[model samples]
Target: MSIITFEHSFFTYPQQIKSLISEGLVDFGAWYLMNDEQTSRRFEGLQTRYPDRRLYPFAKRDDNDDIACFDGSDNTTVHVIHDFANSGWEQKEIFPNIDAWLEYAEECNLQNESS
Candidate 1:
């Protein structure tokens, strides 16, 4: 089993996510794992000061601001951090799971490449 080492706990990743990391599709250093290097990028650097405000950051958004996180408490549903109209900041579900999230990310990558 592949494990990501951290001070508090070791993080286990899904097979598909592991594959993406191996394939260089996902930045494991900046996503998937919570290391010192990634702390600043998560939640657009908000997590450093407001750790209570984050769900569980997994990836960064297409705009390079905000973060893609998952609700580790209730359900492991994927969420992207965003500033809503009146809600201020929130975890917006974009995909159901890591698999679906990866597919969406691939689509975005392709779009960026083509553009």
Candidate 2:
């Protein structure tokens, strides 16, 4: 399982998107760049280079990182940090950073690996 890290949260709005693109923080056909048609078009010209890989955006409704057993097929799942609600820890606060979220993911992966 390969994980890509973005400097900003997935819910980041417009200007941040442009800034990320300008800064080369995202790659063409990457989920952060090709998740939407508007952004996807920017890489349409390079489709031949990345033929097999289609971008899959993190689905907002199914944002939780819970695992579901699927009938043996190649599938991609994205775990967005915003989906988990802060349960009154530090007065019900939320920490929104990819680094923190990635740490959570690493912990989950570690537990899964141990089990």
Candidate 3:
């Protein structure tokens, strides 16, 4: 049900992500993919605020301000950025791709739900 429906032509999500969406597997527990407007707005804001980083935000954590974004240079590797980080991109955690991120998100969700 988390499959995103983008209105804008700005969908540069990785092929793996697209494949998962096509297979109806978009939800990752607490991490939800953003809608077109949300993605676009957050992408713009992130770019302006952190010009050194090339990030394309696609998802956000429901409980906090953390965001999951694709590396704009490759559109494959995923980065999880923490809002509390004063060092900005330095505090971002890298995942090999959306697949790894999905696994991590699911694990985190399970832990959160059990507690």
Specify the highest-TM-score model's number: 3
CA displacement after TM-score superposition, residue 59 of candidate 2 (Å): 6.9
Candidate 2, residues 1-56: lDDT per residue as tens digits? 32323233223333443455567655321123333543233223223333443322
The residue pairs that clash in candidate 2, if any, are none
The C-alpha TM-scores of every prediction are 0.54, 0.27, 0.81
Best prediction by lDDT:
3
- Write candidate 1's Cα lDDT for 1-115 as tens digits: 3333222232333455445555656443323434435633443455444456545555665454556665445334677666332344455557878777766766666776687
Count of clashing pairs, candidate 1: 0
After superposition, candidate 2 runs with Cα above 4 Å error: 1-93
- Candidate 1: list runs displaced more than 4 Å: 1-25, 28-36, 40-54, 83-93
Q: Which wins on TM-score, candidate 2 or candidate 3? A: 3
lDDT (C-alpha, whole model) for all candidates: 0.52, 0.32, 0.74
Residue 14 error, candidate 2, Å: 8.5
- Count of backbone collisions in candidate 2: 0
